[model samples]
Target: EQKKNITYVLNGTTQIQSYVKQLIDVTKSWNCSDVTYTTVRLEDFFADIKEQALGLVEIYHQKIDWKAEQSDKKVTIAYDPMFRAVMNVIQNAVEHTKENGIIYIDAKEQDGRLTFIVEDSGSGFTKEALLHGTEQFFMDDTSRNGEAHYGMGLFFAKTVAEKYGGGIKLSNSENTGGARVEIFFLSSQETS
Candidate 1:
């Protein structure tokens, strides 16, 4: 009789623990999905502000060691959520840049579409790093002066750009030997 009661209590406790673990796993997956969605929206909105700030810095030349150029037509798009995506790229550049490093923001129309470029005077990625850089949560093994980098910036940036019917490209600058991130946006009429 006592043995039977003990067995019942043990089984109940085991079942409860199993249920709790399953709930936690589901919650984590949902949180990841939410973060991805929110980050995409934020990026779309921030891209414009980034362009504007770069423009103002070019015109004033006050604290403007960097140079940015944009097309005259001013291709505009409705950005739903604008914070995370844009900031990730900008923050990466700022983090890698040395004091007085030159950053360039340029926009141009090519093949009837608009493209935005962010170039920074910082150590560019190596071939191996660049190849795998877009993977989620990929951090470069090389550290520069103890700088903290999680390696998720480019991944998130690319995600946001694609969500808005655009894409991101990464390369090294031939002129400045720095890093360049080009965002390509097709006109609404063009097929993705």
Candidate 2:
């Protein structure tokens, strides 16, 4: 039996609306039934997500620092799932970071793995967040409440990565004192 405080909602309507949309996206990622994997050019994959992320960041008045190495490479991935997973990671950054905050995204292949790193210029992960950030329904909010903080973003990303024999590592970025989330996959070894 809870209700929104009208005063708060009225005062923060725009921010709350943006948040609701993000929550909707998070909810949409819960379905895995139609996920299909395909080998895609690294350049295409990078460009697609970059475009999407940039659009979202613009709405929030934020910035991105992108670096993609070896864009000519190819990798087999469930395009949408992985894309949404990566977006979820980025969106997490976008949501937590304040206005004008910068997110660093890097795509690179090394040691036979393809990795997408997303770092946020937000308060770094809380001790609890670092330990269970990817666990289903785990949120670091002290209140431990709110549909907006369902804590599924990283979990969904982790699930998608694991399906491809990869995983996400969470840590505080030494350069920014922010959260760093790296999702990696075993390279397809396709030299196309």
Among these predictions, the greatest TM-score belongs to: 2
Clashes (N, CA, C under 3 Å) per candidate: 7, 0
- Global Cα lDDT for candidate 1: 0.56
For residues 17-86, what per-residue lDDT tens digits would candidate 2 score against the true structure?
7657656655555566666768888888888989999999999899999998855777776677778888
Best by lDDT: 2
RMSD of 2: 4.8
Number of clashing residue pairs, candidate 2? 0
Model 1 weakest 10-residue run by lDDT: 36-45
Candidate 2: residue pairs that collide: none
TM-score of each: 0.58, 0.79
Worst 10 residues of 2 by lDDT: 142-151
lDDT for residue 35 in candidate 2, whole number 0-100: 61
Candidate 2, superposed: residue stretches over 4 Å from native: 1-33, 143-147
Q: Runs in model 1 with CA error above 4 Å? A: 1-76, 80-84, 109-112, 189-192
lDDT of each: 0.56, 0.81
Q: What tens-digit string does per-residue lDDT give for candidate 1 at 1-192?
A: 999999999988886675565344334433434433221222333355566556544443422233333333333443322234444565666666676567666645556444667677778767866687766656677743256455566776676567556778888888668777877555432232
